[model samples]
Target: MRVRAESPGPSWADVGLAEPGHGWSGAVLAALLRRRGAAVLSHDTAAHLHGMPTPHAAAPSSLVHVTLPPGQRLRREGVAPHRRDLPAHHVGAVHGLRATTPERTWADLCTRGAPWTPEDLIAAGDHLLARPWSRRGRREPASTPEGLAAVVAALGGVPGIDAARRALAQVRVGSDSPLETRVRLDLIAAGLGEPILQFRLDAADPQCPEVDLYYADGAVALEYDGAHHLAREQQARDARRDRWLLARGVAPLRVTAEDHREACRRLVEVILGRRAAGHRIDPRPESTSQSGHDAPPAES
Candidate 1:
């Protein structure tokens, strides 16, 4: 039910008292209503409302995405009108405003006409499938990986069907961040063998230490270090874990947001060399760094 609002404005009190963060979404919803009473917010606008990754300029002042009822046509400045019949299940209300469900929003983004790149589309898909972590613990996912596949199947002839299919094929479960998705994609593009995701150090303990990407047979673990991983506390913990992993004959590698692509290339070479040599590769270069931390997070 979240809607975008511009600035402080009148506030979205009607939609449960708009907090400062709701201002942009409040304004977005209000504008959609003013343009076409029955228009349903959709595409990137819906993606933003659903708390999904979107482009830099997806705020209210940008083009507002709305899908009108079939055969209801009208054009106005600053509004993008989508002509389609949204089935009941594909449409839903959030924070008080009508927007496409997460599945449907992703479908719209994947369609041919949408501007999203394949990497971003896959990233969004990963976000949709990865289960949420709540105070009580991990919660049920908003949609399943199978459900997303079905969505792409149902939209076979849609505008971006081909791109959607490609993106869907790239989506993976347990991807916790866009950076992780990017690294996976980069590795795949480099023709490296697929790395097992979120591999645990102890299968018996659900809360056991895990690596971002792991090669089980080779005992090679790769981690994507974001800025928070550089904190002293996190570094200390990582140092202990790295030492433990080393003691157990596992090789640990770290890639940062700034240098993951190149690092992944080097990793592919290492993996290939290890596969040829028929043994685990030793951790190198990066291991010499301070406290075994990875790269810093990108500045906002």
Candidate 2:
């Protein structure tokens, strides 16, 4: 099926109907591949294929990005052509469609002249290095810090490589969501030292719960409660975990989706030995304290 009419010729042809779940973009990519034997998806297109998180500020575009050889070009109404000879190792198959590897896609994105902020780039890198847990179990990270470093080194002297390097320095493993990365960056910018990611209270206990971000010196744990935490079952589980931490003298700070900045502020206050006043900081009842005594609203 032709995707757009204003193209020089047919944008995409339906050779055989795309696989059941390939989606429209996948179908378009398949058609482009058939027409141009050496086209590979790159940039944002490849990032989506690899399951990277989209920046919240990014405006949706209908353009499909494809990279072709230096002398070859395929300009169409709904297509953005990048003419560069990608190394063989940088190209890979994602769900049957050829696309840039996660590392290459990241490098391409950093240098693509897009308006991605430093935090945006760091979040993307954290995603690439994150080993998140799912119903199936802990999933393997898409790429490693070393792998990303290699990509930057290979593309040295390329425009925007410096920005990529700067972001990479701040990228850490174990960030489950962009919000977590954002909060961590905010804390660092506020002059709070970097908190440990995925800190387990007991290393020997396989069942020990891990805190999203832990400041050992202050014994504070910051949990970024995303929308998923609003579920009744998850909330109960979180409550139990908070109680467990409280019993151990660790201050558990629950940060919901609505008030991350406030949460960070409370955390800094806790670290500086001052009680934060105003909006609720702890997930427990206002009257309860870590010591199981009736406590005032603010920590003392």
Candidate 3:
């Protein structure tokens, strides 16, 4: 089993040589390989050594996540170990170990770039959240919410402990159901007011209820629709849902992936005019997010 180095020091050769590739320690394993002129990647380099996955961007890998004590230096010239305080719950494990359980990994990446999604985050929770803290099972409840309201708010982006709290806020999962959570983050970043989530329409067609975004009281609905909505059957069903909504004297504002923030701005304008009886509304505009390090590995 792969294990953390117990209070490891840097040099391997100084400790004494083992037969062939045999007596080398982890540090020695890395150093002697460098001496032989082979390029090596450390940290979560090999697949699934720890929960952190293959990086999205193309930078050389380092044990960038495994923190070292302040004033300590890397033995290999120019190679640096990232230094951060170890989380309290990490017991019986060496500090500066080259891993951060999935949850901790996700928390570190949020909004700081390594590019993660709500779905990836939720999928990670299955292995990470509320688990035992043995050295082997290091995932923890660092960033998720225990309740729904907090889930939505945690959906708001922050860093470290705050980011963990935001991720926890809206913990609903499944390969299929990230709609509300996805839309909320998009809208907030776009500077639009938050909309009501999971609104349901009640009428004669109780057999097939529509998952709505806006309320008829002049409040607009915003759906976190994905490409799946464009599939033949889903599109037909959406058409029917729209017609039913129209018949009830409600005007439905539809948005697709191509037109997110602009569409939201128009809808909010409509809501202000229709719901508040011609009162002018000016919603703050949001800037778009940029591509980050975790763009997923390129096809070889």
The local distance difference test score of each candidate is: 0.68, 0.72, 0.40
Q: Please report the TM-score between candidate 1 and the true structure.
A: 0.77
Better of 1 and 2 by TM-score: 2
Candidate 2, TM-score vs. the true structure? 0.81
Model 3 Cα lDDT, one tens digit per residue, 1-300: 123468446443443322221233455444433443222222332113233323323332433223344554445443434444434332122222334444444454443334345444443332233232355743344332232223223334444445444444433321123333344445555555444333444423464333434444463444546676779997887778777656655556666544543535665566666766732222212211111111222212
List the lowest-lDDT window of 10 residues for candidate 1. Answer: 290-299
lDDT of 2 by residue, 1-300 (tens): 355545433212332222222234555667778888899988877777777766657754356788999999797777789888889999999867899999999888888766577877888888888887889988888997788888878887877888877777777877888888888877776677777777666655565567788765567778888888989999888988898778777778877655554646765666656223222233223211112111112211
The whole-model C-alpha lDDT of candidate 2 against the native structure comes to: 0.72
lDDT for model 1: 0.68
Query: Model 3, which residues run further than 4 Å from truth?
Result: 1-102, 110-144, 147-193, 203-205, 208-212, 261-263, 277-300
Deviating ranges (above 4 Å) for candidate 1: 1-24, 55-61, 112-114, 134-136, 205-207, 261-263, 280-300
Angstrom error at residue 142, model 3: 12
Q: Give one clash count per candidate, in the order shown.
A: 21, 1, 10
Could you tell which candidate, 1 or 3, scores higher by lDDT? 1
Which lDDT tens digits does candidate 1 get at residues 53-77?
6542233226667898888986766
